[model samples]
Target: MLGERVKKLTKLMLTGLTMALCVVAFSPTVKAEAAMLQESEPNDNPAQANQLPLNTWVKGKMDDEYDYDVDWYQFTIPKRGVSQIEMIPDSTNTSGAGWEVSVQDVNRHEMLQISGRTAESYKLGLAPGKYYMKVSGIHQTFVDNTHPYNLRINYSESEEWEIEQYYENKNFSNANNILPNKKYTGNMYSERDVDYYRVKINGKQ
Candidate 1:
């Protein structure tokens, strides 16, 4: 009889210890999982805080001419940021001697001149507000081919970099201020009624 009683007492103590361990293992007060969940909330909308100001773009087409000046390409940014400008040739179009891009700061009277091939781009980081991209056709007028050119201008602070590229020909040197291998696929021309390059403002994230 004493042996049986001892066995029963030992079983009861083991059962009690097991229950105590289970309670400690799954305690409600020590919620490690819930604490971890709270940590993920802060970074959810980190990009929303860096939103860039609104921007507009204007596009224009140039016909065969020695100096097809585009003085009307202008706009104002509500805030200062980066500007990406491209003088792309219409995919369905062709150029005889290619086009040239230039800029003149309204206040400083400074000028930047760059020549572009069939699909080339020029990017500039400038202060906010009014600026101009004075585009014209290059004069290899000796070539008897009709040239039609297109332009694209994008402005944004959220973009990774302000860059330009060209790929119509196989020239791969950075001599023309062109960023190598940055390919672009978009509407080459924005209709005849469109008279200026298009600008886009990217949101910060």
Candidate 2:
């Protein structure tokens, strides 16, 4: 009788321990869901711009139930250079609807806007400072809250160099030789003007 009692006690203890472990493992999932629900609200202004990290993609949604819903993201340029901003919609909903992605300065002045369901990137020279990005539905009645989109920002340092016009080397045969990994800025003197540049590669890049 004691042996049977011991076996039953051991089985009961093991079952209770397994249940406790399951609860601990699943608790984080419940908390994450709650956090996402909280983040889905009140993101519609520059003042409430969600701070985003550079070069990282973030997911967001636009609620169709709301007439006007905009998601704002804020990022800072470490230094003056060319920054690329990408807005890509969910692949499943690309054919169904569209969204408008716009970039604005810190003062809320519009800089650029692109509208479509396809992925697009904007390369612009920006000063080292903070900027705001807004993403909204193209049409108020057609927005789909079930679909999610992504946003990313990348920056590359600018190299300053000058290229004078009317140089002796104007043709491809006499192309003005340039060094690798350099940025050159020049202007076209007339509408019927062309500039040729060549770079010598020593080996496989």
Candidate 3:
């Protein structure tokens, strides 16, 4: 009788230990999978969805050459999902005269020029590609005072990012080359003439 009782106790103890281990090992996996599912889900609001893990972006007034800014005469847009664009003229209201925005392909060829508020932003409805933005302030009456006009671009892909001023000037260029991909070329806009400006290769090739 004693031998039988001892054998029964040992088996019960072994079963209990095994069950405890299984519970601990599987618990972590279940939690991790749930978190991942939440992240993968798509939100109807593009602006809200792009708030996850912050990525590198460009902004601020065109300073010296390579220096970028965070806010102020500044606008924010996502490099990914950008369906809207806003123009903030300096106190001088440079935009009151007129403003133009444009986009270019990788090869620096002019893809499109948008005049008026209707064309401020474009929804391509395609995957991410190498592109740049150009802005021009057109004024009928010449404002002798130099005003700092801010450009704001909003893109929506996975996030809503903005690119203000990417100064591809001297100082930060190698052998007279302003960061091959980040340099943009644009001339002061004119009322009768189409203003030419290029988006610094803000994104990769």
lDDT of candidate 3 over 89-192, digit per residue (tens): 44534423344655543444444455542245443321145544554444442243333444444544532222222223212222122344453333222233
Off by over 4 Å in 2: 1-40, 91-95, 140-143, 160-182, 185-205
Q: Model 1, poorest ten-residue lDDT window?
A: 35-44
Q: What's the CA error at residue 102 for candidate 2, in Å?
A: 1.0
Candidate 3's C-alpha runs over 4 A off are 1-82, 91-95, 116-119, 158-205
Measured by C-alpha RMSD in angstroms, how accurate is candidate 2? Answer: 11.4
lDDT for each residue of candidate 1 in 48-120, tens digit (9 for 90 to 100): 1112223422234443344533333444544434555555555546444566665545442433456756544
Compare the candidates by lDDT and give the number of the best one.
2
Q: Write the per-residue lDDT of candidate 2 for residues 20-102, one digit (tens) a residue.
A: 99998888665533222113457788788888777777777776555377888888877646666777765555435567888
For each candidate, what TM-score against the reference? Answer: 0.41, 0.56, 0.33
| Local distance difference test scores for all models | 0.44, 0.67, 0.38
Candidate 3 lDDT for residue 78: 34
Model 1 whole-model lDDT (C-alpha atoms): 0.44
